[model samples]
Target: MATQLIELVDGPLDTGKPSKPKFRTVRKDGQIVKLRIVDADSPNFSADLTASFQANIRRARKENREIEDDS
Candidate 1:
């Protein structure tokens, strides 16, 4: 029922102030699912993912090729 309305509008139908992301409800695996903003054609599941590790080696290489002595 709700899915049809969403599809007809190609997105949320709400037009309230302070526009924000919209989420809809659906049934998946016998459980209710909240469907948020997502592009089925161009998936972006990693848009909010952070880097695995810092680029320590890259930073070191860019700092200086020669070693400094403080003795």
Candidate 2:
């Protein structure tokens, strides 16, 4: 299975700081999974999360294609 990076964001907590970007890597298995953010309370939480997820998906796909081409 190909490895993929999943980007995520950590929203500001009660301290009221800005959001911080985060990432995780996982194998690209042919299965869907659920992600649960325990306590995200940012105004742009959904938008930020969606953007990060899509960006990482594109990035992972591109990287995988490059690796395949090299083989």
Candidate 3:
């Protein structure tokens, strides 16, 4: 299976004195999935981004299981 990446819609997290991590999602075939959190809050903030990410994760998990079965 090929790796899938869900681009984060959020601009960027605020990484100043008190920095909040930015959020991103990644799906790898044989590697552990990872969330890329950066800093730099952008004006473009979408709630769906987070929601979609959750949904993508659920789907990826199912896909992963199937891949394992194939192996």
Error of 1 at 60 (Å): 33
What does candidate 1's lDDT look like per residue over 1-61, in tens digits?
3554343556644433322334679999999976554333433323311111123355566
Tell me each candidate's RMSD, in Å, in order: 18.5, 15.8, 16.0
* Per-residue lDDT of candidate 2, residues 1-71 (tens digit): 99999967688434333356554444458655444342367686766666566666988899999999999
Model 3 lDDT tens row, 1-71: 99999878678654333234455567688776657453335443344345445567898999999999999
Q: Tell me the lDDT of candidate 2.
A: 0.62
Tell me each candidate's TM-score. 0.25, 0.43, 0.34
Which candidate number would show the highest lDDT if scored against the true structure?
A: 2
For each candidate, the alpha-carbon lDDT, in order, equals 0.43, 0.62, 0.58
After superposition, candidate 2 runs with Cα above 4 Å error? 1-39
Worst 10 residues of 1 by lDDT: 45-54
* Candidate 3, pairs of clashing residues: 11-42, 12-40, 12-41, 12-42, 13-40
Better model by TM-score, 1 or 2?
2
